[model samples]
Target: MSLKIAVCIKPVPDPDYYDQITIDPVRKTITRAGIPTIINPVDKNALEAALQIKEQVGGTVTVITMAPPNGEESLREMLAMGADEACLLTDRAFGGADTLATSYTLAQGLKKLGNFDLVFTGTESADGATSQVPSQLAEWLGMAHLWNVSEIKLKEDQAEDKVQELQAKMKIENGYIEYEVKLPAVLAVSRDLNTPRFTSIMGVMKAKKKPLTVFTVNDVDVDRTLIGLDGSPTKAGAVFTPSLSRKGERLTGDLDEVVEQLLQKLRAAGINLEIKSSSQGGR
Candidate 1:
C-alpha cells in the first residue's frame, strides 16, 4: 500500500515590496482587491514537504482547505503543483470563523475524506498569524501533533511490517531537536523546511483534467449547528490600528558629559537610573 498524505493550504495576499494589506471592517473580511494572491508561504512549504514524502514513499498527495467557493482557485493551484486530488469545504455557515471554528470545519472535511497516513499544515497564516488552527485540528481529530518542523525524514519500518516511522528535526531557540514519531500524525511545517516548486506548464494542463472534490457542512456529516458563526466559540470583537508617537533627542559631547546629560534627562523624565562605579571605569 502507498502512503496517503493530506496537506491543508491557504491563500494569502501576495507580499509586495511595500508589504501592505487591506481589510474590510464592515464585512469582517480582507479585501484582496488589486492585491495579487498566492499560496500562503508556510503552507507552500508544507505542500513541499508533502510532495517530498510522496516522491520518496510512493503515495498520493491530497490538498484541502476551508474557504468561500471562490477559494477553489487556491485548490486549483495546489493541483497544478502535483497534488493528486483537492477538496474545498465552503459554506455560508463557515463564514466569520475564528481559528477554533475554522479547525472544526476542516476536521469535518478531513473526516469525510477518509483514511490518511499523515496531515500537513503551515505553522501560521500570513494574515491572521494566530498559529492556533493546526494544533486545534490535531486536538479535534485526536492525532499526534508536531509544530515548526524544519526538516523531516521518513524511515520505513520493515520490521514492524505495518507501520512507518518519521524522524523530524525541528529548530528550537537553543538548537535543533529530533522527534521519532509514528505515522498517521499531523505536522505543521515551518517556512525553513523546504522550497516549494513552481507549477509546471504540463502540470497545469494536467490539473485541468484532474478531479477536484467539493464538500459542504452537510456532506461531511457534521451538525449544521456545529458549523459556521453560531457554532463558533470565539468572536471578532473589534479591530483598530494603534497610533504611534516619535520624539527623541540626540546628544553629542565628551563621554563623561554625555553620560551626565543622559542621567539628567532620565531624572527629568522621572525614570529611575541605577548607577554603579567600578574601579576600571575611568581607566
Candidate 2:
C-alpha cells in the first residue's frame, strides 16, 4: 500500500500586503473584510514537503483546511501547487475556535479521510502564533508528534518477509535533530524546511479540473459540541494597543564620562549590570 499524507493548512491574510489583522476584542474572531487572504506561509512549506515526499515515495498528498466556504481559494492554490486532492472542513458551527477546538475539528476530519500514514502542519499560524494546534491534533489522534522540523527523509528497510519499515529523520533546533522510531507520526514543519513553488498558469488551469472535496462537521462524524465555540477552552477577553510614552536624556562628555553617566542612569532605573570578562584576551 502506498503511503498516504495529509497537509493541514490555513487561509490567513497576506501579511506583506495586509499587516493590520484585527481580532475581535470580545469574540476572539478574526475580521475578514478588507484583508487580502493567502495560504499561511509556513503551511505552504508544509504542503511543499508533502508534495516532495509523494514525488519521491509514490504516494498521494491531500491538502485539508477548516474555514469558511470562501476559503476554497486556499484549496485551489494547493491543488495548483500539485497536491493530488483537496478537502475543506467548513461549517458555520466551526466559528470562534481556539487552538484546541481547531485541532479537534482537524482530527475528526483526518479520521473521516481515513488511512493516513503521516500528517503535516505548520509550526504555527501567523495570526494565532499559539503553536498549539499541531501538538493537540496529534494528541487527539493518538499519534507520535514532532515539532520544528526543518527537513524530513524517509528510508525504507525491506525485511526477508518482504515487509518494509520506514524511518524518518527530522532536522530540529539547537543544532540537533532526531531520528524518530519508524511509525506513523505527525510533524509540524518550520518555515526553513523548504521553499514552496509558485503555481504556473497551466497548473492553475489544470487545478480547476482537479478533485476538490467539501465536508461539513457532520459529514466527518464530529460531535458538534466539541468542534466550535462550545468546544473551546480559551477565549480572548480583550485586545488593545499599549500606549507609547517617549522620553530621552542626552549626555555630553568624553567616552569614560559618558560610560559613567550611562551606568548612573542604569542604576537610577534599578538595572543591575553583571558583566563577565573573557578569560582569553579579545582577538
TM-score of each: 0.82, 0.81
lDDT of 1 by residue, 138-208 (tens): 88778887888898988776766444778997688878889998878899998899988998999999999
Candidate 2, which ten residues in sequence have the lowest lDDT sum? 158-167
lDDT of candidates 1 onward, in order:
0.83, 0.83
Highest lDDT: give the candidate number: 1
148-232 per-residue lDDT for model 2 (tens digits): 7876777654444211334444555457466654447788999888898888998899899989899986688887778788889
Point out where model 1 deviates above 4 Å.
17-19, 22-32, 160-163, 245-283
TM-score of 1: 0.82
Evaluate model 2: give its lDDT. 0.83
Give the distance in Å from residue 146's predicted Cα in candidate 1 to where it truly belongs. 0.1
